[model samples]
Target: MRDLSPPAPRARGALGVAAAVLMAAATLAAPAHAAAAPAGGTAEAAVTAPAPPMGFTNRDSTRCRAEFDEAYVKKIADILVAKGLKDAGYTYVNLDDCWARPARDDQGRLVPDPVRFPNGIKALADHVHAKGLKFGLLAGAGARTCDPAGFPGSLGHEAGDARQFADWGVDHLTYADCGGGGDAEQRYAAMSDALRATGRPVVLTVADQGANRSWEWDGDVAQVRRTTGAGTDGWGSVLARVKQNLPLAAHTGPGRWNDPDALHVGGYGMTETQYRTQFSLWSVMAAPLVIGSDLRKLDAVSAEILTNREVIAVDQDPRGKPGEVVASDAGRWVISKELADGSRAVALFNETNRPRHIATTAGAVGLPAASGYKARDLWTALEKGTSGTIAATVPAHGTVLLKVSADREWSQLPPLLDTTISGDAVARPGTTQRVASAVTNHGGAATGTVTLTLTGGDGWTAQPVTAASTDRLKAGATLGTEWDVTVPAGATGRHELTLTTKYRSRDGLTFTSAIPVPVLVGVTRPPAGESYLGDQAPLAATNGWGPVEKDLSNGESNAGDGSPITINGTVFAKGLGVNSPSSVEYYTAGRCTRVTAQVGLDDEAGTQGTVTFEIWADHQQVASIPKMTNADAARSLTADVSTAETVRLVVTDGGDGAAYDHADWADLKITCA
Candidate 1:
């Protein structure tokens, strides 16, 4: 006989008293067995014996049973034993439903597909038992097995099926909710009672379709109850299920556990680290460690992560307390567990797309650090001092699990509310309106009779902002309220809307929000200017132009009669210097043939200084001079030119470095009628 001593308890430290109180409350609230039975009458009970203390193999019987040859059954049993499941406190290898043929034999008995299990189910059970493991079978709570195509069901023959399992040397049974049964709790209890009536200790695993609210009803009638749906062998699916189980932790205990479906650690689509995280969370939650992956084909890393004793201890802790989420956002979560010993297990998880720094302090978790502390990183096998805080960098979609132990006595912190302003609110002109403000409570307790006041707003009259109702603002909760105010007509500027909240503190500690309300009044319009050609206009000019092109000179010429004229040029080749000029000079001419000119240039490279040029024209429009380009090469250049009866030109350097050297041109022509 093997010694199956109960798992060891966790070390003691802080958080012990509160955790114990909560655990006691949960035990008291657990449902009684009799409450699980179907209402108003007992049907014939099943005769299946309770499962033994041995791990089992579960397979989809309907599809593969015909191919379930002796070689396959032996291979499965070998893998289960090799994984040391029996030695690690697991038994009852179960075969999932759909193992039977469409119809029963003439004797009205469920028959295994002859070709799949040629030697029969009983023979398969014998083979499993010979390998030091238990064999279990599946059935549905509905009238028929899940074979919707028409197969046998346990609906009216619960007891008869139990008897069949008992006679076949079956040690356990997994009852799934199929065919849309009414009241899953009732159905589960019926099957449990029927199986127990056979005078066997058959381990009963129930699938409640994630709707049984098992936390409110499960007791001794079920050793384990499905609280969520079946899972895939992917990190996302695994993490989702883990989060779902967080709230359900209060319902798990000795001889009863929250079934987060089954394990997929070594299965398809999961990385080694992901599998480690999955196994770690499951163990911490004290969930049943059922294997869903193929053990025979598992890699060494998968096997090692699944079997770490230190991490496993957290899961199998005798206290059986479930962890809860302390904080979560953007794929990052902080979870804490109350251990049997006084310490708490804190896990900081980064489920984001990138690595992130996560930190948690005893004060943040409402734990006292007066006693000092130590943190042991379970994944890395490293220890650190956590006198009052625990912090670490978590990889993308990874986690940091630490055990915090305090040496002195401390009390949980009182709840608090932290307020922040999201951004400035804009109020439209000519209307009195209520603008909503957001407030979040980060405290440990609820706040009552909270009042908010609008301090002041220049040029604006403040009105009362109404809340949905007055109630206690609980910790970790958020609420929104609007401020009513009138923006006077023709108000065309910005204003500050200040607000403050008043509340009495039950714990003798007052909390206040640090941010102030900044509101903008009146609409913001673009400056008065000609609307440019682009969709956005003047804004486009500043943003659209590429790098300046050097060694290029260009400008627009004007007519002498004060009218604008166009200048034409033909480019011979592209150059590497600045090709565009920033500003254009305008000139005027007074005569019938007046000419106007604006010089523009496109500079690709920024190497350019002041380039000098000379211009000649009549007296109405004179000869003009061009200076050196600015240090910053011009992207576009334009110059306004005008014509006159007589004109003279002079050119001088403006201290700019590079000249317009690429394409040389001499004649300047301006158009005037």
Candidate 2:
């Protein structure tokens, strides 16, 4: 097995070296191409790249389907107009997966199911374009669509498929796992190249499912990449996707954005508050605001969520910076984005099961109270004045989205710490405790030789465990270290542990954490033969035992043979045969010992019954009251056994007739003294 421990400094350096070598190899294999020349003979140039077709939009039927009909299509056009989505810059109405048919026609062209799309894709695109919108389509990278055995895949048929989509007026195309083919990047590039050759400026949306960290490099090949799975309307799903995509914010741009799948707002399985929270998060993340609900049937709350201009502004901001989490805890979180106008858009989210008051000072978010700010609650449509700081009572799984501008002038505020720290703690014997601290440097400049002191309790000693020698933390990076300290052993009640970090320019800050370590005097074990035993049967139900006899013949049983069992339980056979050639055995946990049993026909064995027995703690098997077995009779035979440590038990079939040589067990039990 590979070592799971964190890599040493030398090993990390070596990994960087290996990455450089791999990049060099890739560069050599495929020489970088030059950008196409611009129309004017100036030094500037234009770049031509493979992209998704123009009119594609991702759709989810579980939430809403982009069905093709005059009424439905017109309704979507109207909703887009009413919401001003078109004005804000959303155009294509792309159909995601699950919209295709099972087979293609003899002409090798995909056939849209007439029942769902009677006017066909072309008519739908025409209608959308007439309304100033575009139509897009979806297909799988594998042989079959997301559907089991659906339409033919777009693997080797990339060129033909591109032409087909072009002919159908497809403006955008979303491809997933393409034909489930070659390397993810290579396959995506191939499809993009194929689409580009079709003389159509189709916008290519590569759905890599975020596998292999493709979002980090896919920007060069596709217009956008899905950074997470298909989205759900649930708040948990939205929060999870947002947190996962935050690291990829640096990769987003005008032509490419990190898609947190689609908008689940106003969809099923979400409350009004949740929908608002979802919209706020997606907008802050700069994710595509592709609505995934029945636009015509939207409720009032859904309409409000989808049309919030302030929230939408953060998403459609020209700067295109994805928001990053600035503060996060069990109940609250804060994410911030740098806007193009030298301002910041901050979102304070409350994701607990209940309402919470999430507060953050201006300094915490890198803002000065001297710069008076205006806070707008996106969900409530209310505006509040702030004196360089903001705080609010956010509902459960809800948020307060704000736009903080530094244009306002106010009195200067005291200097404060810009760094934040988070960590976990564990208890140890004596007066010592172990704590791991993750220090985040949010300041513009790097910090050096910082000291973290632990105070309080009767006696406390702090010693750095890791990252101490360097004593430097770089800007925008986090440094983790452990500290071992001694606290009075007799301390029983909660005591405060203060962390103080000193820097020259920045003010020294103190953060207090309460720690309670209970004292344990002694440990005890259960009395002999009364200890609990852990045992479980295998999950599979089958006819043959492993590596043992394929089939049991005559009056023989396949019990315990070749199987491991805990000897804690009573060993038994459901249906046992006397005078049969059948037996089974099991190995103990340590494999130190084996137990076996055999039943033989007695001279006076006239009646058909069962033979019961028990095993004692001394590893001795004892016969209990004897029971009779009649001719062609089936009966259960059980035996209880005990051992010093733990052991295994085996039961064998001893019977006369071949038909009576089997025993079946419905249940087994283990009893402690």
Candidate 3:
């Protein structure tokens, strides 16, 4: 089967939390290995959205492609509606490539392939509607699809093709292309416009497919935004596709969905357990439950899995909030969703072959730990009695979906808001640095009221600026502003900032988001020389790091301020370097000339933690160690900073946990001429 979306390396972890201002600077700093900058800005986010399709879909590209015609489509529709899929929301039958002829008629309109659909597209659509089912068609956004058969695409003919689709009473149009026309955002928007002009409501779908990061910008232009590329049949393919959409959960909701391609249940290369896993995962993610398998060959196992009314209810919940991975370890994965009614939907996934025991407490998922709730297994449709923790024995590649309802009302759409600050991380003791703050709405509905208050950090003067928004922000939309932060003259140490966001949901529920932001400033600009041994350094700290003069944990400072860091098990912060390691530290030297610092990975070299130390001078890193395991010895590093005023020390986890990142600067000091 030909897949409409292109393939690429899998990318994960797109969302994160708030860090202190100064630490955020170190973590947000450009990495040594940086990718190309994003091409589209916030404007690309879909604003005006079309009405969403509230039903499940079945597409041909997964198995049959465009091989079958009128008889085959009607047969599948009959099976679905007859088997009770229609009432359960499986209502669309989509026709993919090879459905159209190579060329249009004399009027330059698309013509159905005379051989495949001799009865014409309108006739088939009519047949579909006669059964109370909707019709869906697939076309490319370019001159041609990857379809070698030369089926005329809807690229330059968006309006004409759209008009034809509307006239034929088509209900769904999946717009995918190989990128041969203008901007992707514009091309898709054009089709949306053309379809709307026809005066018929069509569910327009654009394949975001990782190429354009379409999930971020494919605002309401289309009903659903395809998040991943085409999915394969096997379990490896299924898990790969599923994990890739983890960080993207924030970008999807009610009106728009993050597609993980199709569902291969009881289909080619799939098993009963894989089927359950796929179905359960899709439901929690709020993904479209499109059946890519054969509806004609429904077995007891497949039918039982598909018609689970309880599972379907979770998917079609009115709140429209998607589920996300809360905790993962070894072969066990835990995902959670906050249902509209304040209930909780939790799934325990076993990825390995052998059966595994997985358990999670209600409190871990926002439910009161001590509060007892009724637990119902969506798979078995049986109550497991009321309990605080729900534990299950799951088969390999199998999933257990549980709907936990407590006595307390906990209904809310959730917090889909994330804020980011940009500008300068470095500020002079007496001057101000103007930075921008951006808040992205990744939930289902608009935010009620958003307010930003800046509580200034230590050793600073000027008043802290604040901002707020009362207007409701659209899903996938972003709002931002600039703030002027000043540092008082002769101030010292690290400046910590507390940025708070107080907002309400559409339901009039109040929510507050407070984040810590740290700012770095040198005590003196120039002509002031400072020196200290590695363990005796007074450096400002970021996200996880504490005051440089002493260990915040107190336990790790046992090596004494005069000696190197010796005791392990105290990793406070991990820098913004690779994999967002366990912790990160940033330091700046003022008016330093030639600085020689003796850095050691661990004072207790006998420990098992791994730590790497790096020195940064101005824009480029002067010296560094990449792989520092527990057994590696320490060394002295010297860098020339005569022409520079700021230098940073970055520490990272060495492909392991930060339990032993007992780094120490024995003889760390900077002197000016």
Candidate 4:
């Protein structure tokens, strides 16, 4: 058996000597294209070397597919350079598992897969360094790797592996989730000490699956630690990771971070809205932003989402303080992070499937009350002035990220205004809908000639019932106007009525802002009674692993991948099957009496998962099971929903980590009067 002891530290100047010897050998071993390291003369000049720079990595693409090879890596490096990703702070090109052989050499040194990396590891690292980028490699801690191929891991070979990686010019090392036999802390400490002994400032990442609550102690062991399990392309996965990572904000700082895994923005199955939410929340949480998509074929939408510098700036903030949850209620979240410039980056996130109007104040997000504050939407790159309130109607599974600063000259810009249409914009053909549009000015200076105009396409006509124009508005005043909007007689689908507000700032600058008022013409809601909730289609559903299943349990992945909805050992014929951190919503239409079901961790989870089941009526938690582990039997649950317009089924990761959290809502039935 190999030894698991820490490597012996060398003399003060041994690093220079080793570097010199490695450079001399590289002349003959490296290919003609590989660039040799600097002479040993310059090696001694380094009093200290910086750790691997905190930046993005491309590990997700390599792990999701089996296309891990030198050529693929080089192509990604090329794309990073040519597509301006390097300039956007994505500076690391990481090689995940399967890059090494199944066994070590006679000398017990891990070997690179000769077929995949013909030029060897040293040559590949040199190639990456030549392009002004850092190189990272992944290894496991167990006897065998987590990969299906079970490649050689760094379990008992941590010292030798660290030295080898340093010699090959690797700038980062990630310990995979499997293999350390004894105490996890001891194994991790052995590798951490070994890396330091080499005198190479290689960044260490501990991907321990958060099994040991690593964040509490990983600050000294690794530069980064995984705070949650591996993520999928689903929105619920993002939610689960964020939910698990939020409370651990205090555990993160300058060199240490809570990693929520890699980016799933583009090339994934999620919508652009969800992708932005993922990126925005990751930035707010101060998590590492590792790209997880094929960069060679990255789409324009994904590129734009990944390259938003304003958003990236928050993640790379010098303060390094992770965002803390300032407010949360019924699926709406507000996270606030303080930046080095005394500004705050705030994110208003809507976790539900329905559009929600989330509100917050500047002071609530760590900003002092000022005459006016400048709030810039990081995603849209739009700026608005606000006196105190910072709010928006966030889309479903979307976020509005803002950078708020106390700008004294905010009055020179456009006036900060809140536009709200009180009554529902739904109407019948040829029928008029009366709604009130309230415009509140939150700027420091008064506005001149504020006018509210409603304009729709051809057949739509809107006339103001109340005064639509104000000659002069004082600071922090609101103008309320009522309008009678007549929908087109033949309109049968959803349409929008544009409500435009035109006003002049104190600087005499004309500005116009528009808010779309949605009108569903001639639309009707389904009746209250629905048999076997699973039998009816949900208004919206999101699962962590795959699509939510009906009458079956949450499976490994993909829709229809599950068996019967079984809890403990009993199988139910009718109910919804979902992964943890999942949600399924139905329109109750205020006619439902109660919701009853049997909830538990699905038997498919074996003896490994834990989950919490919650039934929400509108914004209220009507019923919940505090905790249910795989060992627990199915528990009957009932929720009162006599006055709810909507009912939601929610499953969360029982306050541990989101791993194998398959859940079942068995025999779900909603009774209505």
CA RMSD, predictions in order: 27.9, 20.0, 23.0, 7.0
Query: Which runs of model 1 end up more than 4 angstroms from their true locations?
Result: 1-70, 83-86, 147-150, 363-370, 407-673
Please give, for residues 369-421, the per-residue lDDT of candidate 3 as tens digits: 54355666787665433335566556657898999766332223443466655
Candidate 2 at 340: error in angstroms?
Answer: 0.5
In order, how many clashes per candidate?
Answer: 120, 51, 27, 1
Whole-model lDDT values for every prediction? 0.52, 0.51, 0.61, 0.78
Candidate that would win on lDDT: 4
User: What is the per-residue lDDT of model 1 for residues 570-628, given as tens digits with 9 covering 90 to 100?
Assistant: 23232211111221122222322322223322232234434344443421223334553
TM-score of candidate 1 on Cα atoms, chains taken together: 0.52
Per-prediction TM-score to the true structure, in the order listed: 0.52, 0.53, 0.54, 0.88
Q: Residues 1-673, candidate 2, lDDT per residue (tens digit)? A: 1111222222223453343234223322221122222112122211211111111133553323445444565567767777766654556677666555676788777777676677777777677777777666787776666654456677767767877777777766778774466677666666666665555555577776575466655554566787765554455456556656777777665556677677766667678777877878878887777777666567777766676767777786755567877887754888887777766788888865434556676656666445455555565554433455555556556777887655342212111122233332223335565666544443334555555554555565667777632355554456566877675655442244555555332233322222222222111212333222213221111121111222121122234342221111223332122222122222122212222233222212324323222222223443322332433222333344433333222222221112221223222333433
Better of 1 and 4 by TM-score: 4
Better of 2 and 4 by lDDT: 4
TM-score-superior candidate, 2 or 3: 3
CA deviation > 4 Å runs, candidate 3: 1-67, 368-370, 408-673
Evaluated with TM-score, which candidate comes out highest? 4
Query: What lDDT does model 4 reach?
Result: 0.78
